[model samples]
Target: MVNNKQKDAPHAQWPEAAQTLIALMHAQGEVARLSEREQLISSLLVSVNAVLWAFNWETRQVLYVSPAYERIFGRSAGLLLADYNQWRDSIYPDDLEYAEQSLAEVLRKGAVEDREYRIIAADGQVRWLSDKCFINRQDEPGQPVIIVGIAEDITDKKHMETELQRLATTDVLTQSSNRRHFFECAHREFAEARRHGSPLAFLLLDIDDFKLINDSYGHPEGDNVLQRIAECGRGSLRRGDLFGRIGGEEFAAVFPGCAPDMAVQVAERLQQEIQRLRFNHDGQAFSITVSQGLTNLTEADESLDSLFARADAAMYEAKRQGKNRIIAA
Candidate 1:
């Protein structure tokens, strides 16, 4: 009963209205999907113990910070968000200047910057952090420059590195500096002594009858003897003294600010201490002695090697002179 024009008008408008509704729904679905994906990625970063953040360089404010900031930095996200200085104050004093300089460089170049530095947590624990930041410049006029960044807690990794370095430079048997580390330290001490014209004494020590002990009681017992000798020597030396195991049954000590007479007295006391050590292995009780050679820095000595050679020669002379005495070179 309706007019033909009127009937066609409603039908034509229906398709256009439906299409617009469908497009709106699709757009909403896409927006929701993107938000979910971003949240999932953020959760992943938190799971891996990383903090994600965005900073506004021009405004000098933190625009965004992940939840992981509370976990890693031991500071609440709300607190840091309210005041940027809360995060800045957490940085260790020594590292703050360097970090500022690095940030300045990144802003100047408008590129990525990476730095490793130390931070003090709210719990009074010192932690290491590795930070990577990328500059995001705004194309629109009057928009603030932004910095997108991530920071990771690298304290455990840093500890592992430090322990590895210690193992590399230290002797496993005596827990003293190894031969290579000994030389490295000695070279530096030698250079400084030469520059300042200071008195520096070097002493080489050898375990008396070490081979005999190894042959008599096996290597384990011989190891015990060496450890005892090292303990005695360490107890006799001062804190500033450099003592290290230079070879099997051979050790060396560097005494800075010690004269030839003081070196002789120290060597004598160390020999006495070693002689007093009583070692009991498998019901076999015995004592050991050490022979030492002493030398001092001299203008005639051109290099560490030359000085060490003279000390070695004197140590052999001690061995020749009854195997339990100290000789000066």
Candidate 2:
């Protein structure tokens, strides 16, 4: 317990009470060390803007919730540490098992993993985040030392991914799904509807005399017609419907949960809209029209070949009828 004065001081000058006070000061040094450790942890949490969730290895219960919990998730660690479900329930339902599975895997291997999941906010808004942690394997039975992790908000990153997906699947010119992306998506919709015993329809459409327009007024004018028609058709489409360009001046529409008759009605509207389409080129007014073929696939198939074949046949039938008309098959 002696630091400096205790070793050199005379016994008469240092009474029993003075020696006792020196011992007490040595004890206070231990207290100061403890305080410094706690402050270091507090500063660490604040510096990185992180919530540290510390768990005891053997009890499998949370031992500490750093104040960063309030700063990040708008909740107190005191409440969260008392109940594990408070944090578990905040995770998105779809990601709940993922989180549990990841933890189980980590425990078995004593490894660290960086994972992400959605968190439901107090305002009922959902956000995504990622965590990084090190698995502490200190002296314990069937346990670890401490499970500490840091998390960050990735909601904006998730939104950016969604917008990028839209760009990949859509055609900038016609505002329709591109040909390759359309078939991939349509086949999925067809298979799902067929599995559920639901009805579905497909429509094949082509502008009447499209080549003549391109040959006469040029491709730009013809493109103008296609864009306008897309806008008009999209206006009448249901939220789940899809329309896409499959070839030059050729388009396909997928009608999920709709019967053949309903598809025929949709085709009729498209026909009328195209028939009435008008545009001006260099102050010379002109109009364009289209012929459409409509068909339904009652049987489920992995390939869109058969469905398109039927619609193609029906479309030729419309073309043969002098164009600017809809024929259902």
Candidate 3:
């Protein structure tokens, strides 16, 4: 309670002790600061959506994993730390080999930044991950080699990309391949067929009296007919055949490895399917028909344009002769 001398006595009697006391106080402050820093780092890791992990490659063990492991994988981090296979088992079966191979690549390359794969979460939901990993340490005399990585959930991004691709490649109303996408694929198929000398048939189809139907039944019904026709084309074609809506009331198909006879049968089946389709408007039922022009890849053909010209001319010929018929070129 009282004294200036009392406070100074210890310092005066043992100067070394006083210095040690001061050093001890500073150390305590440093410890507290370190603890706060650690807590802050922990909090930041927990708040992030990506999982950060460290693995002891020599021992084949997981050294540490962030809290986001549980959130993204829907599995316990404790289980992962206990057994590395927990992570392995979660990888999609088809992707497991590539995942392991790519991770191993990090050893040679020191980093793998372009890795992406799929994993099945604990809730049985499949999620995509863009996992980038690096060698945290090189092999030392006695130190354990460490591999560190960050795994980010990219399911939403993958889905968005897929939807974007579908939109870019698909017709909105007919749900068939769009004209540009169809031509792109057809040209590739044409080159392949030419290279292999394989039979390739192209068929062009046009709905007969389409304007009259649209005027009588309204544009909505016309759209419905187009969708139905696309559905028929999809159902009637072989697995590898390509079909698309190329223009208003006009559709195209590329049949790879299909001979002329088979292509004719397929075109006939599609025609019959369209004929069987019955649409109703204002209590009146009506049926639609299509004229098809079919052409086979000839030795003289150089590009898809030539095939298109022949098929277009043949389709016009069919339309001129009569409606609802198939003509071969």
Of candidate 3, the 10-residue stretch with the lowest lDDT total is 136-145
Q: What shift in Å separates residue 70 of candidate 2 from its native position after superposition?
A: 4.7
lDDT of 3: 0.95
In the predicted model 1, the residue pairs found to clash are: none
Candidate No. with top lDDT:
3
* Tens-digit lDDT track of model 2 for 1-329: 77576666675576887888988998899899889998997788677755666766556688877676676677667778787777887888999998777766656666655688888876788888776565676676855567766677778888999889878988878978989899998999887887898888888888888888888888999889889888877976777998998888898999999977788777777777776778888888889888888888756545568889989999999999988888888
List candidate 3 stretches off by more than 4 Å.
1-11
Sorted by lDDT (best first), the order is: 3, 1, 2
TM-score, every prediction: 0.86, 0.65, 0.95
lDDT string for model 1 (1-329, tens) is 98999879979898999999999999999999999999998678768778889988777889899878988888989888788898789999999998777876777777554688899998999999999888887788888788888888999999999999999999999888999998999999998889899988999999999999999889999998878877887899877888999999999999988888888888888988988999787898988888898999999877888879989999999999998888999
Better of 1 and 3 by lDDT: 3
Q: How do the residues 5-74 of candidate 3 rate in per-residue lDDT, one tens digit apiece?
A: 9888876878888789999999999999999999999899989999999999888899999999999999
Candidate 2 matches the true fold with a TM-score of 0.65
The residue ranges of model 2 lying beyond 4 angstroms of the native Cα positions read 1-44, 55-63, 66-71, 74-116, 120-126, 131-149, 192-198, 211-224, 276-285, 298-303
